[model samples]
Target: MSLLDADAHTAHIFTGAWTRSGGGDAPVVSPSTGTVLGRTGIADADDVREAAARADKARHAWAAASFEERAAVLRRAGDLLQAHEAEITDWLRRESGAAAGMAGFQVHVAAEECFEAAALASQPHGEVLRTAKPRLSFSRQVPVGVVGVIAPFNVPLILGIRSVAPALAVGNAVILKPDPRTAVCGGAVLAEVFHRAGVPEGVFQVLPGGVAAGEALVADPHVRVISFTGSTAAGRRVGEAAARHLKRAHLELGGNSPLVVLDDADVEAAASIGAWGSFLHQGQICMTTGRHLVHASLADAYVERLAAKAEALVVGSTEEDGAALGPVIDAGQRDKIHRLVTAGVDAGAELRAGGTFEGLYYRPTVLDRVTPTTPPFAEEVFGPVAPVVRFSTLDELVELAGSTEYGLSLGVITTNPMRGLEIADRIPSGIVHINDQTVDDEAVAPFGGVGHSGTGSRFGGTRANLEAFTETQWVTMRADPARYPF
Candidate 1:
């Protein structure tokens, strides 16, 4: 059956088999038209505990499965994702306000995530250690039992799948709690994929719920690890809760990332990169270019060009109008975006292009003459508002870019790539790009940030995934059993 079809066998809370949620139904409302697209079951705290118990019960057998078996399942899941790309993209566009291009990107990356995770299943899990005595000693990675993955509404599929695929491939069972707002695309689609890919019963579950469910997942004794992707405020709470439970929490949190256009860079090309960095997916990305630091010589031209690009972008409903940009996730986010823009303008930043909205369709806004003190300039606006400021020297540029609490992604446009690297060396970001935009991701690349942006451990790539999902155990063996003396 199609994954989107609402049925008892494809409900919101899936534990071994699909089942109705304990919490009441939650409506999936379309951002564009304010229409109720559908309704799915909502999971409460009790349901989260139940899911965790089931996942923990099934984890040992899953961990004992042959490496080939785990790899096969992940590989099949990647293939299935490509097969249902169209349907999944449609769901993302309708439910999460993802633009057509953004939705396709999510599907593509999510498939690659599965493929990369598949490769991880067969990689060497441990290293041999030298021992002075007549004994063999080695450390091997092992599953940490059940993992809880809490995902956000924006970029729902990729964020959730990145953690889910790796945890499952590394032999840990997963209980995914996608944001209730994006339950269908983030939760239901994944449940269908794993179920069809021959994952064992009780090994994976998708519980779509609100704060209570998320809190329960963290507190559940059976869930030993949590991979959470969301706002920094919420991530801190999750981290604190996970620490209280002694569970490992891998957090990919919020960012107010910067894109620096060096003095010698081509103004037109830099503007193009800046526009895409700040406006793609309506700038709802954690790695979106929230601050644009342009060298003083090129600042004026850069602002003009950026404003022009912002004006040209068609902001409307992706599903209905085939717009280049879509709405902010919902009304609350829309209000936040506008409020930040207004505050910036009032605080002395000049509105260069946008600053208006029609219904939920917010125009791509450019705020020039923006100071560090300007609203949204130093904050994670998480909207399509680009604030451009000038830097007179390399020291000023470095200081400006590194000022924010977030250290996620950094982009630099420069004539000399080495010069860009030198600047990046002084910054605290986890990911950096020369002559590229701030928002970029690869399934095989280590993806995460530093400081408030994320935990130090990354989510993607082989080494990172293995470390994130598995625990290392040191084993020592002698020719004969050694006796311990009191």
Candidate 2:
């Protein structure tokens, strides 16, 4: 229940069926403490191939299962996850340095994804088509057979389940490759839940591994689709491989989202939204507010209030009770965030508050006088750092918000609802929030990004996943027609 011991590692989830292949065993250290928490077994090409083949085989029975049967399994998985909430809360923090609030929320979202997928198991079956002849014609949705889910260490539970739930609901087997950092607690948890919830042995596999295992899964012939959530560079590689194999790929890539504040908006409320959106999860989220564009008239007051709020946040390990902020995933990420913040200051931006790090725990940083060209503003400084830039006019803000290569999410704040809507409507982002911050995700809402952020593929909602994970086939029947021309 605590830290997911090496004895509880997910190696057996793969080796219980096939012998552990290449890449050998590796240790999973707590990102917050730098202490080894568990060990994970890596799968080789043969192992990945075997799992894919079995998944393909398993799909036939799972696909043939009635909607009610599939829904029952999913609902059971959700209930089981809820039962394991305490364990989840304990290990997720150590594995990935998630705060208590985040770890709890991640469990809630993962369980909810299972339930939502259960309810949508029977949707988008088939639609009747109009035919000239007195014959039946319709289009039906069919599963892609096998889904290769490659999830990141950040919020692995939510990311992995989001793909698995929908893929399984549509009657497809899933092969999950979780990041090595949180393998045991992240990937194994899903495997354990589904296996206990009635999914077949080979129907689901948890491979806690590195590049070799991931490459094997991607290159496997039986893998019909790939749902990848990670860095844009890595995602591009996955996209290329999927393209080479002509496999369907839905990518949830990087984001450099902006939170815009208008002159007439509430500065305190906007600052609170900004602090939470940027600092939550140490700003490791793809939908994190990377750029903060505020009107010049209120930028000073907003940054002043935001700095006080950031300073008050507690930064420590989850073990320390009441700690609001935890360490970053690793020292490397923390250093990179620090570098970005330093560069922004060198470029004439002002470091308003908390620009230091102790271990992996980087304090919430606030930067003002940032411009569209500033490194922290332009690049995805995915750490607990907020770059506040002043814009004189709405047109200026819109242009600054769109200056980045990424366009996953945008937030607009204004007293006038219509004014906020006007700005949100013009922003070049997949998700636009009129009064809310950018870090928002719902089980039923379609969630994704545009431009460099993603492949424009929505991951949630009834229509998005049902369409993404399935192939439509149009069938036509002619019983008594004789209309062929000679």
Candidate 3:
């Protein structure tokens, strides 16, 4: 299908029903080629309220349904996802400018989350506690109410599905406000799967729109909990809105993650892993490592190796094979990255290699002599750029790594296991990886950050998301009121 043709179509699903949005449409473009893939609506505040109310109404029946019933629906959704994996991957590649392999990986991850939620739903929410007085107390996990999810453009499907599946499996209706840039690939496809899975109307709603829609969703009293994955600034806004309603808010914000290389480390392996981790999705991921803290002893050699690897990376369109990295989401993001890199150069940091920007394509960048004063080191550079900072001692390195406001994820590469463990303990990040980069995420492991990174965990095989979307109720009965009188 033609890119313009795709852009003109809208895939809207609400309450198990499908329709297109009635409003001015925003074009979704490929970051690699600047080609329009599809257009989604810039939904108004009223439309967002309607979507939230629909979910609020559907929550009653959905929450009251049996666990088995919910599990069946999620499992069927998983099946539909698998059957349409190729098409979904194509859409992601076109809309997000994601490499084919990366797009496929995201689809697989989302599908796996569906199955994980299904399996988890059958498990017990609590265990009965026996007491001497024969007073029965058992905690039962229940849905909190309508959940509001705001997903980012990068990794839209993976993150969205991760949050949505668990929320639905736990019996809460969901309202998803996808990144306007990738709604067609992320929210639209998800709506299709939910509809085919026979989900009840209003149980799952995908609102494709802009900031106004997001503000409306978060501010709505009907939305009991808000789960947002985006920039630190946006996350703060969402949290504040949730606070107004005294609602629970889950924020997965931006990261300036650090990769520490100890003196006794494998420089080559670290460089390769860092290259992939930093450049994947053009460095758009929240957990992507943005800083490289190398022991001063090995700083020179490490930069040389890292620079060579980064230069060797194939920067091209997602459709091309052997392309390690693609373009940024758009000209705006591209320009932002350029300004940050330029500022870093002006701040006296040496531009080691790969500082090329043509349209949306930004060549992977590696800078040296970056200190806390440099914008590239202090701010979250959400592009294919890496800043190398040299530290002399372990204490200095630890202090430097912990200086950032974000405590999302950290990576340490060293041959000494004891030293690696010691550094991991000192890092303030929520997740610490030894001998690898920060991009290595496991489906079964608890994944999230601390401080400004995020508020809650995403994975870990635990029902964390389910618990976040649920509340506890206490019930009591007294055989002898006089014995237990206050």
Candidate 4:
């Protein structure tokens, strides 16, 4: 059976029920083999409006549902996701070009997201407030009515589910807009999971389409909050649109994170950490180590070690020949990655290893002698390319790392843990890791970025989830009504 056909209904757009929407079917093409796997439904402006209206209508009853009922739904969804892990992982590997490990990670995180959201249902939802007036006063959390979630092609399931599960648990109906490139695993799979879990009709819908669908979702008055995860440019547009519509936008955007290797660090250990950060899942993650800053004393050795590590990685289609690194998402991304590598080499950076591709598979690349001004170093390449630069002093390293507009994740590697922590404190970013790689996420930890990276309220754990999906309303009760001065 086809992977998409195994567990998820990929034939139609999910608007509570499967419905043929505006743009019709779009072929799901595999990045690994360049073959059409299946077809998924697409939504357009009108379809988005229809889904939004339905979600708005469904919001009230869901909000009024008992916490136990909502938690039961979430728990069931989590259980279902785990029970069908093999099918989901296969779909992820085929559709998203994820290797076994990466695909497994997605399934794990996705299930954990649902489980965490289930726990949110029973958490405290209100706070009692002290008032000067003789009255019982408190603040309670309420759903934001309807949430519009826009997820990216890379890390599709995790990105979409992070928002979708939380919003639903908090009692808001959701309309998810998965990237057209990854609609099946990202959108349709979630639809199947929630549907089988007994989510109320109109409480959750998946609309897979391109720009028009996303724009329509943002403009729709019924969508009270927009949770967007993608490129910085696209996120800016979503944020602006949500602002114009006067709604909350939780944006988890792009990053050009730095991995700092101190002179005191072990060259081999540091290289291993950097390689994992830069090459994992083809380095398409938001927190991939885009820039590697090595102490001038260890720069040469570090570059050689990192290059060796990059060269050792086997790049191929996992289906044909099990490989460490699978193909990138598509040709466009492959070309973009090559272009950045070419630009870096053209600007005097030495290509230490891997500046080549076969089909959609781009090899793990390492560039040495890269300066702060190098093209790939300055931007988020979003590929398996590590650009290493030398920093003469700690201050120089801090300056080089902080020079970029993107501030998502930062990693400091050193033997002295306190020293690493001190260095990490010097850099301003949403997430900082001492003696660890930049690419990391936990459902229990609050995840987001700062500055251009995101609109940093945050997006995990109890408080952040509540803040992201719920609004606080103040209420008061009195034994007798009191009159104000007329």
Candidate 5:
């Protein structure tokens, strides 16, 4: 289908019944052209409650199914996604305004996650333990109850799958609340694939709406776990609500990740990788390297090389080939980025290159001499902006990097393996890249953060995902009851 096709925006399936809560419909728009593609049904409090209850009802049956049976269903879902990759990619590009390459990348990640989840479900369950007495003890990982997954707009499809597949692999029913803007392409698509994979009705449901639906879902008693990815403020709200019910809350929140470039680093390589990591997805990623801390001696050269590389990036719609950058997800995010960039300039930070804002398009920005007091350096600038800070010594650089409350991810650029290892150890982030930027997230790595960035982790491998959704239960079998009489 062409990018302009209006039919592409319609949701394929919506299993949960809607209520008359008078919630207004939400319009899904294309960031590239700022045009409304279609409208999604918005669920109010009543609708959200009903969906949670439905998922709760389905949980026991799904959990009781054999592991092989569940695996078969997930594998079929993977096949379905592979079959419709092109259609899904087009919808993602239109709904999220991501470049074609980025849209494709998300689809690829989702497929991999589905396959991984299936393989994990087929693995052996429980382990045997030996006790001091003649008793056999073992522990098994069992799924928690219904999981509430609230996903973000940027890379919605990929992030949603990261939470949903794991919850399903562990035999837990899921209540997914995707970002209102990209629900059709992200949440709706996943629901369809899971259904095609033969997931029983109500086993997994998508609740599409705004904050009202999300709040209701998190507050529901049936939901035993909550996994969220979004702003810090919203994450706090979710965390607080989950706490009321004492639910297991896993949040991957906002980040102002740092990229440290030591004097021994390869300036050319660092500049190239840094530019890509910061500008990719227009820097909408939570793990995007928004702050750059470079050695004072190499600061000037690093800035020059980074500016040149940033200039080379192509900015346009995803439909156009070779477009390296795309528009921000929406106008609100664009305005936030612009305000931070403007604040940096006013705070005496030098604009090394591109600082123009036109509509949803913000030029790849590079600001130098940014301090902790500056908005760009301190805040989560979720746009294509990279601010550079200078440090005189390795100790000072490490201190500066760890100063932030966010510890999501950090990047270190140094050719010396020993120095890279030493720097990685000092950083507080959950995942640190050596001689690379923070955007290098792989499916096999433990992806999460420390401190305010998030709680708990996701996506190390199949076992990691399974663990995230399950709790350990110990079972002791005493063949001779009289032997242990006290």
Candidate 6:
């Protein structure tokens, strides 16, 4: 079945159906070939208000629902997603410019998110507190009422579903605002999941809009929490707005995640993993390994090996899968990547491989001797550009990795796992991977960043989601009324 009618003009998902949100329409184009696959209407402020109001109105009933009832719906949604894997993955490729591997990973993991959330629904919510008085006191977790989920274009399915599944499992209604770049799969397919799974109308919705709509969602008093995934700048705005309204906001923002290579590490293995970490999905992922810190001893050989791996990658459109990389989200992103490349080169960095571009599909690029002060080193490239920096000492590796404004993730590769851990401990990051790449996430881990990268609110696990999506209530009981100071 069609996720949405191809000719449909609106991008809004209302309760159990697709509705015409009032706003200007825009054509959804593929960055790979500039093909207009579909069109979707932007949600105006009024539409956003209406959607949130609907979610708020139904919040109490969802919160009061039984755990088994909620779990069943979430499990059904996951099962449906798995059953329709081929259909959803295909749309992801065309609409999001994702390669087959990237698309499949997003969709499949998104389904698993729902299943994991179902498990979380049955876990203990709070703890009993010891009191001096002859009264029983304990805390109970209650739903936050309404959650606003704002997802980015890079990994739409996983990002959107990761937030939605947890919110629903905890019995809070959700309003999802997907990036216009991937609305069809991100917003519409998600709506179909809950609707077919028998989730109540108005409890879950998808509002297809841009900045105006997002502001509207955050401004509303009914939206108690906001979960956002995107750039650091945008995340700052979202966090500030949520704070101004006394609402909780979980931000999974930008990352210039670094991958380290020690002298003892396997240069070939590190090169292979680093190539994928830097170039997968054209390196738009927030956790993409944007910086490469190799010890001086291995730096020369590592760059050569890394460049060979990058050069071997096939660059083609969606029809091609043997090609490892795909286009960035759009031309603007492509231009931004090129500008960073130019800046790196001007700073005396050598372009070891791929600095060329054809449309939005910029080839996987490698930069050697990128200075610590350069944009590609200090900032996130968000493109398939890995800026390699040579570090002479362990202290220099720590200093270079810690210098960035972003502290989302880091990767350390060494023959000794303990050595990798010791170095990883020195870096400030939420995700520290040993002998691996930076881009990583699962349904049940605490997935957020530190410093400029996030608000320190983790997005997975029973405790994490409960903390993010629920309020704690201290309940007490006494056998009889006791006299107190008046």
Give the distance in Å from residue 210's predicted Cα in candidate 6 to where it truly belongs: 0.8
TM-score of each: 0.98, 0.96, 0.94, 0.98, 0.94, 0.98
lDDT of 6 at 26: 78
Could you give candidate 3's per-residue lDDT for residues 254-359 as a string of tens digits? 8999998888887788888888778888999998989999999888998999899888888888866667787788888888899999999999999988888777
Q: CA lDDT of 407 in candidate 4? A: 90
* Residue-wise C-alpha lDDT for candidate 5, range 1-486, written one tens digit per residue: 222233432532255322223355677788888788787767678876777788888989999999888888888877888888898898888888788888888888888888888888877678998788677889999989788888989989988988898789779999888888897778778877887688888889877778888888888898888889898889999989889888878888988899989888888888988898799999989999989999999899999999988888888877566788878887788888888898899999999888887778788999999988888887889899999999998788888898888998888888786778788898888888887889865566668888889884755576667677888899888786755356
Model 3 TM-score is 0.94
| Counted clashes in each candidate structure | 0, 0, 6, 0, 0, 0
Off by over 4 Å in 2: 1-21, 480-486
Candidate 1 regions exceeding 4 Å error are: 9-11, 483-486
Count of backbone collisions in candidate 5: 0
Superposed by TM-score, candidate 2 places the C-alpha of residue 357 at a distance from the truth, in angstroms, of 0.6
In terms of lDDT, the poorest run of 10 residues in model 6 is 7-16
> 393-445, model 1: which lDDT tens digit per residue?
88888889888899999999999999999999999999999999999899889
Residue runs of model 3 more than 4 Å from their true location after superposition: 1-15, 130-134, 458-460, 478-486
lDDT of candidate 1?
0.91
Off by over 4 Å in 4: 1-8
C-alpha lDDT of candidate 4 relative to the true structure: 0.91
Q: After TM-score superposition, what is the CA distance of residue 433 in candidate 5 from its true location, in Å?
A: 0.8
lDDT of each residue in 1-486, candidate 2, tens digit only: 432344555445452243454667777788777888767777777778878888888789989999999999999999989999988877888888888889999999999999999998977688999998788999999988999999999889999999999899889989999898887667877877887788876777888778887888888889989999999999999999888998988999999999999999898999999999899998999999998899999999999999999999999887557888888888789889999999988999999888999998899999999987788988898899999989998788888988888989989888898888888888889998888899988889898888889888569999999888899999998787667678
- True-structure lDDT of candidate 3: 0.83
